[model samples]
Target: MKGKLLIFLIILILTTVPAIGADISGNVISESGKLAGLIVDLSKINGTESDENSITGVTYDFIPVASTVTGYEGEFVFENLDNGEYRVNVTYEGVTSGENIRLQDDTFVEFNLSGTIDGYVFKYNSTIDGVPVYLYDFYGIPAGNTTSGNNGTYSFGNIAAGKNYFVSAVYAEVSYTNNVTAPASSDFIVYDTTDKSDNIGVTIDHIVLSKDANSILVYEYIQFINNGDRVFFSPERTWLAIPTPRDISNFQTDVMECCLEREEDTAWIDPMIPLMPGETYSTEISYRFNPTSEPVFFNRITMYNTDYISILSEKINGLGLESTFSESNIVNVNDKEFEVLDFMNIPAGMTPDVKITGFVPSKNTGSDLGILLPLLLLLSAGALSYPFVRKKMLLKKKKVFTVKYNPDNPSGENGVPSGGNSEITALGINAENHTSGKTVEEMSFHELLAERNNLFESIMGLENEFNSGNVSEQEYMAQKKERRDSAVLVIKQLKDTATNLDLTQPVPELEEVIRHIDDIDILEKLFEREEKGMDRNEVKELIEDRIEDIERSE
Candidate 1:
C-alpha cells in the first residue's frame, strides 16, 4: 500500500508542473532554395543600453544560450528555451544575417540569403559571344570562369553576398576588368586590336644605381607616352625594347610576367593592355651586375625617342661617373647623397655610353699585418709574465670581503655588492638606463602623448620620402612597420593610464592625437579605447569618419 501511494504522488507532481520552456526555430534559404548544414547561433538578450556619444548609439548585450546547425531542409531549432528576448544569427558563405524577437511560447524565424552575379560582355557597343569571362573575389582569388553564351551573357550564382568581386574578360588578346558587388550586374566594353604606332616615346628615364660588396644594383623607372590619336598595339605585343647588360642577374620587372620577355641583351616590354592615346604608363625594372674592369662602361641603345634621362648614383668611396653629361647636381635621398647626371632629347636608336670609374674593391681586415702583429705581441708578453705574476700573487696576504646591506643606500653606495642597477643585466640592457630616458611604466601621460605625436610625424615623413622616390620600397616598408608597432604600444599605454585615472571628459592631448592618426589600425585601437578609457563620442565618430574616408580613398 505504501509503494502504490508513493507512485501515485510522483505522478501527481509530474502532471502538475509546467513545461520547461519554449522552442526557437529558424531556417536559411537562398536562391538555390534551402541551405543545409549552416550553423545558427541563438543568443538571449541579456539587456540593452544606450551611449549618446557613441557612433553605434544603442547596443544590445547578448548571452549565448545554444547553437545548432540547419537540417537538410535548412531548418534549425532550440528546444526548451525559456520565454524571453532572444537573437538568431545565421552565417553562410562569409555573409551573416540575424534577427531578434521576444519569445512568448514557440517562435519561428526565417533568413533570406542572396548571392548572384550576372553580366554581359561587349565589344564596342555590340554584345560579343564566345568571350572568356572570369570572376574573382576581392582578395584576387579566382572564383569561377565561363565563356559567354550566344547572347553574350554570363552568370555566377551562390557567391557571398555583401562582398566585393572582380569581373574580367579577355578579348582580342587584351584583358578588361571591372569591380562589382554581389547581386549586381557588371558589363565590360573591350576594344579590338589596333595598328602599332611610331609616335610612342619615352618621357622620362630615371635610373638609380647603388653598389653592394662587388656588384652594382640598378633600378630603372621608365615612363612611356603615346602621342598617337589611336591606341598603340603591336602584332608581336612588343611595346618597348630596353637595353640591359649582358651579365645582368636577378632581373625583375613590375609588370606581369606575361608582359615581359627577354632575349640576349634586350628586355622586351610587351604589355597586353594597349597604351591609350595621350596617356603615360610607368614601368620599373631592377637588376644587378658585377664590374669586370676598373672603369665599367654601360652602352645601351634607345628603342624610342627619349625626352629626358637622369642617372643617380649612390655616394661611395670609389664610385663615380667618368664625365658629367649635362649640369651635374648632388641630391639627398634617405639621408644619403647621390650624384645625378642629366640628359635631354636623345633620338631613337642612339647608343648612349656611361663610363663608371674608380671601381675599388672593399678591403678585408682578416689578413691585415698591423692587427696580427699587435695580437702576437700581446700574447707573447702575457706568456712571458705569467710565472712572475703567479708568484707575486701567492706571496701576497689574502683579504676577505663581506657585503653589507644598507637600506638607506641600496645601490651599493655603502660597501654592498652592487645589484648592477647601472650595469648590463641578463637581457643585455642596463637596469637603470633607457633610450627614452624613462621606462614605459615610469612615463607620464603627457610624455606618452608627446612620444606618440613624434611617431606620427616620423611616419608622415617616411611616407613623403617614399612618395618622392628617395627611399627604397623594402626599406620604407620595414621602417614603417617598426614605427607603427611602437606607436601602437604607446597608444595602448595611454589607454590603460587614461582608464586608471577615470578620464571621462574630453582631453585636448588625446583629441590632437586622434586627429593626426591616419593609420586605420591605430584608429581602430583608439576606437576600442574610447569605449572604456575616455567617454569621447565625438572623437569616436571622428575616427569612424576618417576610417571611411580612407577606405573610399583606397
Candidate 2:
C-alpha cells in the first residue's frame, strides 16, 4: 500500500510541472548611418506559403510578436518568448531590411540594416555631373535613381546589404552599365569610375610596321597602368575597348604577354586581366591591310593620359620611303630607330590626332647601301668595259662558231667531248642565275612575311580542294602534309627573325602547325632537307620514307 501511494505522488508531481521557454535579444542598426529613432519590428513566422509572384519566388506569413525603437546607440532587444521561428524587420524612410530566423534558447542577434552606395561617373579624364544614375536589382528590377552631384558623385544611402546591383548611367548618348556588390555595413561603398575614353590607362608604347607588295602589317605594343586603389574591370560589360582602323583584315591578338579576349575589331583587355592599383599590363597586337598604290592614311585612336607614341618601318628606313606623320620626333626603340609623335601627357579636354601616312616603298631605291654599292660598281665596270666588250663581240661574230665539243657525245671529239665548252657555259649561266635570287635567310622582312601569308593561303586552299572533292584523298593528304611541312619551316624562320628584330606577333595558324610537327627527329630531318633546298613534294617523300623505315625497324 505504501509503494502504490509513492507512485501516485510521483505521477501527480510530474503533472504539475511548467513548459520550457526561450528568449531572443538583439541590436538593430541602420546602414544609412541614421542610427537613432529607427523602427525595429520582431514578428513570429506562423507558416511559409509558396507564391510564385513573390519577389524571391516565395512568401512568408507572420504575426506581430514585438516592436521597439532604436536608441541613440542603435540598439534594441526582445524579452522571454517561446522557442520558435521569428522574423526581424527594420524600416527607415521607406527603405527596409527584413529576414526570417529561428529563436532557440537565449539567442543574441545583431541586425544590420541597409548600407550606402556612392560612386563617381567618369568619361575618360573628365567627370560629368548632372547625369542620372540608376540602380537595379539582380533580377534587373529598378531599385532607385539619383542625379550626380557637382563633383560627379552620386549616393544611395539605403541599399540592402549582401546584395548585388546593376548600376547604370547615360552620358554623351551612350548607355553604360556596371555590376556592383553592396558591402555589409553603413560604410561607404565606392564603385570604380566607369571606363571612358579619358579614363583608359592603356597607352601605345610602340608600333612596328612592315610594308609589303600586297599589305601593310603592324605590331602594336600597349601598356595599361591602374592608378586608383580599386581594380579596373567591368563585370557586366566590356570595360576596355581597343579600336582598329577601318576595313582592317587579318587581325590577330596575342595575349601571351597579357591575357585578353578579342572580338573581331575590338579587343577586351580588362575583365580577363584586371588592372590592379600600381600594376601595369602589356600586350602585343598585330593586323594587316591591303592598300592601293595610292598613299593610305592610317590613324590610331588614343585615350587620355598618353605617355609616348612611336612608329618604326624597316622598309621606310631602308628605301628612304616618303612618309609623313602629324607629329615628327624620331625616337629609338629596342636599338632600332622609329619616327615618333610626342604627346608626353595629353591635356584634359583635348583629343590629339595620331595620324600616320604610309605607302609602298619605291622599287628604284635599295633597302640598304649594301645593295646599292654592288649596282653602282657594276654600272661603272660596264661603262669602262664597253669598248672591250664591243671588240670581243665583233671577233666572236667573225669567227666560225661550230659545235666542236659535245658533252653528251663522248666519242665525237679527240679525248674532249664535243660541245663541252657550251655545256660548261650553260652550267655557269645557270649557277649565276641561281645565286642572284634571294635565299630564305637573305629575304627581306616584307618578302618573309609575304611568304608566310602565301603558305597559310596554300594550306587553306588545300583544305578547300579536299573538301570540294577536287582532289583524291591520297593526293590531298600528300599535298597537305607537304604544304604543312613547308609552313613549319617558314614559321620557325619568321619567329626567329622577328625575335632578333624584337617584332612580336600572334600567328595562330603557324602555332598550330608547329604544335603538330611533333617528332624531334622529323624536325632535324626537315632542317636538313631545307638546307639542301628540296621542294615540298621531295621533302614529303623523304618523311614518308623515314616513317616507313622506322615502322619496319620497330
Candidate 3:
C-alpha cells in the first residue's frame, strides 16, 4: 500500500507540472529568395497596457528570451519557449522586420528584406570624408547613423522600400539635410569655414534711453551682418567689444556672464554660433546710471563699421537733450514721444555722444505758494549750485533696484517694475522648465519635437525683442540660454528614443490612404493616425504634397 501511494503521487506531480517545449520558428527572405546569416532575436511579451496619454497609445514589456543566427535556408527557431505570446525579429544591415505569435504550439513566421540608401558629402566642390551622417524616418525619428567613407560616400542598407527618409550630414559643426526615397541617392552641399572678421559689419546700431524715476536706463541693439561667402568659424571663440561709459552700472548682455566679460569701460560679447553668410546676428546690451549734474554726457565707441546708429530718448517735460549728431528729430513710439538722433556711416572706433541738460524741478506740484516760498528763496540764493543740490537729493532718495528671476512671469517689457519698490521680476532663466512641467525623459518623441520647435520660436522672439530695443540684454541672454539648453536636452532625448524604436514592427498602410485623399481635412486625419502604426515619413510627405497640389489646382 505504501509503494502504490508513492507511485500515484509521482504520477500526479508529473501531470500537474506544465511543459516548456513550445517552439517559435522564423525565416528571413527577400523578393529573390530566402537569405541566410541574419541575426534573429526572440522576445516574450511579459505584459501589455494601454496608455491613452501616450502618442503610441500602447505600452509593451518585452523580455528577451533567446537569440540565434539564421541558417543556410534563412531558418531560425527558439525551441524551449513556454506556451505564451512571443515576438520574432530579424535584422540585416540597417533594415529590420518582426512579427508576434501566440505560441500555444509551434509557430512559423516570415520576414521580407528592404532596400538601401547612399549619399555623399561635399564642401566647396570637393568631397569630404569622415563626416557624420544620420538617418531619420518620415516621422523625424532617428533610425541609424554612420560616418562617410574615405571617398566621402555613405550608405545605409535594409531601408524599408517605398518609404521616404531624411539624411543629415554634419560637417564642421554644421548640419545639412536632404529628403530621399529608399533605393535612391542624396548629396549634401556645405560651405567652407573662415574666421576672418573683415567682412563683418554692423547693419543697425540702435540705442534707447528711458527715464525710470531718477535713473536713466540705456539699451543698445547691435545687429551684425556677414557679407562673406564662408561661414565665420572661430576656434578660439570670436568676440565683439562695445565701449561704454566708464561710470555705467548694471551692465548686461544676451550671453552668459562668462561670455559677456566687462573690463573698466568695455563690454565684450561672444555670439555663440558660426555666422553664416547673408545672415544677420544681433546682440543687446543694457545698463543704468544716475545723472550727476546738468549736461550729463553719454558716450559709446563703435566696434564695427556701423551703417546707421539711431539714439531714441524719452522726452522729459523740462529737460533738454542734445546729440553730437546733426540729424535730429522728434518721433512717437508706443504712445510716447522721443527725441531721436541719427548717425550714419560711422567708422569703427568712432565715438557717439549725447548730452542732457536743463535739469529743472517740476513746477506742476500743485503745492501752495506759501509751502514753496522757502524752497524758492533757497534755490535762488544758490542758483549756480542748484543742479548739484538736486542731484544729491535724488541720489539720496534713489531706491536700489533688486533683480529677481522668475520663470513663470516673463512678460515684462524691460524688466523694470512700475511700483515704487526695490524688487523687480526679470526674465526667467529656465522658462522652458516650467512650460510643460515635464522632464525631458518623461516627454514622448512628439512632445519633445513640439517643445523643441516652441523653444526655437521663443529664442527667435527674444532676439527680435532685443533687436527692437524692447527688452533688456540681461533678460534676453538669461531666457535665451535657458530655452536653448532645454531644446538641446529635448533633441538629445528625441534622438535616443528614435534610435531605440522597434523599427522591425510593421507600419500601417498609410501611404495608400493618403494617396487617394486630396482634402485638407483628410490630411489632418492622416496626421492623427500617428498614434496608430501608420506614422511614417512617406505618409506625411504624400499628404502634404497632395494638399499642396489640390490647393494649386483649386
Query: Candidate 2 lDDT (Cα, whole model)?
Result: 0.49
- lDDT order, best first, reads 1, 3, 2
Which stretches of candidate 1 lie above 4 Å from their native place?
1-120, 125-161, 173-175, 193-204, 210-240, 245-264, 268-297, 305-308, 322-325, 344-347, 352-554
Best by TM-score: 3
lDDT of 1 by residue, 57-174 (tens): 3346789988889999999999988887887777666544566667888888876667777888877678889999887654343567788888789887766676666677887766
Q: Spell out the clash pairs found in candidate 3.
A: 138-537
TM-score of each: 0.39, 0.29, 0.46
- Of candidate 3, the 10-residue stretch with the lowest lDDT total is 386-395
lDDT tens digits by residue: candidate 3, 1-554: 99999999999999999876877887777756778988888888775554432222235578998889999998888887678777676767665545557678878876656567897887778888888998766544456889988888998887666666768887777666676777788987677777767677887766666544455556666778887778776657777667777755666675778677888788877776667778777766777645565567777666666666666655753344675343345543333455666555555555656676544223232222121222222222222121111111210121111334445654234332222212322221112222567888988655565566556545654665677788899987887888788778977786665544433222222332343343476465555554354334444555577677566545
Q: Clash pairs of candidate 1? A: none
- For residues 256-358, could you state the per-residue lDDT of candidate 2 as single tens digits? 3354655644566544434545556665566664444355555544433454444445434332222222334332222334443333332222233443355
Give stretches of model 2 more than 4 Å off.
1-198, 235-237, 256-266, 315-337, 347-554
Error of 3 at 389 (Å): 43
Per-candidate Cα lDDT values, in order, are 0.62, 0.49, 0.61
